[model samples]
Target chain A: MKADIIVDTKGLACPMPIVKARKAITAMKTGQVMEVLSTDKGSLNDFRAWVSQTKNELIAHEEQNGEYRFWVRKL
Target chain B: MDEKSQKTTIVLFSGDYDKAMAAFIIANGAAAYEHEVTMFFTFWGLNTLRKEAAVRTKKGFLERIFGAMMPRGAEKLGLSKLNMAGMGPQMIKHVIRKHKALPLPQLIELAREQGVKLVACTMTMDLLGLQQEELLDGLEYGGVAAYLGDASDGKVNLFI
Candidate 1:
C-alpha cells in the first residue's frame, strides 16, 4: 500500500533536513510518498538534486510562507 | 520494485575538518549498507581534494622541522583548525579517528572502493590555483550548474 507521510523539518539547519527526509523515506515501503517541509533554503536545491540522483519520484514541490515543501515518492 | 532502483546521495558543504570527518563517516556508513553514495566537495570543502598538500606520510625529526616551516599535510590544512577547547583539535581528531574505527586515509579509500563519486568545484579550484592534475585522479570538475544537473535526480543531497 502506498502511504502519504509528512516530514516537518522546519527550523532545522542544512544537512539535517535532508538527513531527516532521507530517514523518513527509508522507513517507508516502496510507492510511499514522503512530504518534507523545511525552512532551510538549501533544502530546495539539495532535495531536488537528491531526488534526481536516487531515482526517487519528486511528485510535487513548492514554497509558501517562507517554507519550502517537497513531495517525494519512494522508489 | 527492484533493489537496483534504490539509491542515496550525500552532499557535503562543510570545509571544517571535524565536520568533514563526521560527514565522511555517515556517507561511508551508508555505503556499507548498500546505498549508492556521491560526495560533492565545493567551496572550502575543496580542501579535501587538494592533492598538493593534502595527505602526507608521517615525518621524522629533520622532516618534522622542515614541515613545521613548510606546508606539512592535510593534518595542518587551512580551515581545518585545531579547537582551543579542552582536548584541542589534535586530540579531538585522535579521539574521532579512534572511535570511528578507521584512519582518515582508509575512510577515503573506502569511499573510492564503494564508488563514491568525488566532485570538485571548478570555481574553488580556480581560486586555489589548483589544476586538474593537482587533485586526486578520477575527480569530476564542474560548477554549481553541473552539480545541480548531476543531483537533479531523486536521492539524498547533503551539505556538511
Candidate 2:
C-alpha cells in the first residue's frame, strides 16, 4: 500500500523502533497512512499493541528479508 | 483518546540502572501510545535525576555524607545484579550502543521530550538531603499526595 510517510527504523532494537514510529505518526493527519520499516523482531507485537491502544487503523503489515513493514492509518 | 483515562503512573523506588532503564522504556512507550505518563522518583530512584556536577548546599554532617555517597545522574548508576564492581554497567552500555538501543540518559531525555512527567518526591528529597539545585531542571517537586492523585486516575500504575 502507498504510504503518506515512510519511517525507517532498521538496525534499532526493541523500543526505539516503536518509539520512532510513534513520533512519526504523531505528525501525520487523520486518514493518512504511515509506513514503518523496522528490523526489530519485537516490533511485530509492539506495533499490534500500540495500534490497539491508540485505536489507529492497522492497514496492513508484512515482512521481507527479516524487515517488518507496517502501514497504519491515524484515525 | 480521553485524556483523563489515558494515563500511566510509575513509582521508581530503585537505584539500579537496569530498573530505571526499564521504567523509562515503558514510560516512553506509554507516552507514545498517547498515555500521560508520570514517573515518581523516590528513595534511591531520586539519584537518577541528580545533576552530574556537584552543587554545594548547606547541610548537616550526615546529609553531606549522604550526598557524597549517592551516584550523581543517570550515567553513574550501577546495575542491580552482576555489577561486578561496576564492570557490568560498562558491558551493558557497550551492548546498548552496539544494538542501537537508547541508553538511560537518552531515554530519559526522550521521555521528557514526549511530555512524560518526572516528579521527585519531596519527602524523600528532604530525607536524603537532596536540594532542588542538585537535580536536573524541569522536575516537579511533590510528596505522596501528588503521586497518588496521578496514580488514581491512571490506567496503569506501576512501582518500579
**Backbone clash count for every predicted candidate, in the order shown:** 14, 0
Deviation of model 1 at B26, angstroms:
2.1
Model 1 chain B scores worst on lDDT over the 10 consecutive residues at B66-75
Q: Against the correct fold, how does model 1 do in TM-score?
A: 0.52
* Tens digit of per-residue lDDT, candidate 2, span B95-121: 999999999999999999989999999
| lDDT score for residue A49 of model 2 | 91
Tell me the tens digit of each residue's lDDT in model 1 across B1-160.
Answer: 2457434565666655567766776676455334666677765566565564544444466634533443222354433465554246567657645543454445667677656677788776555444565467898877787677756663666777
lDDT of 2 at B11: 97
Clashing pairs in 2: none
* lDDT, candidates in the order shown: 0.65, 0.93
Candidate 2: list runs displaced more than 4 Å: B1-5
Give the CA lDDT, 0 to 100, for residue B66 in model 1: 38
Worst 10 residues of 1 chain A by lDDT: A12-21
TM-score of each: 0.52, 0.97
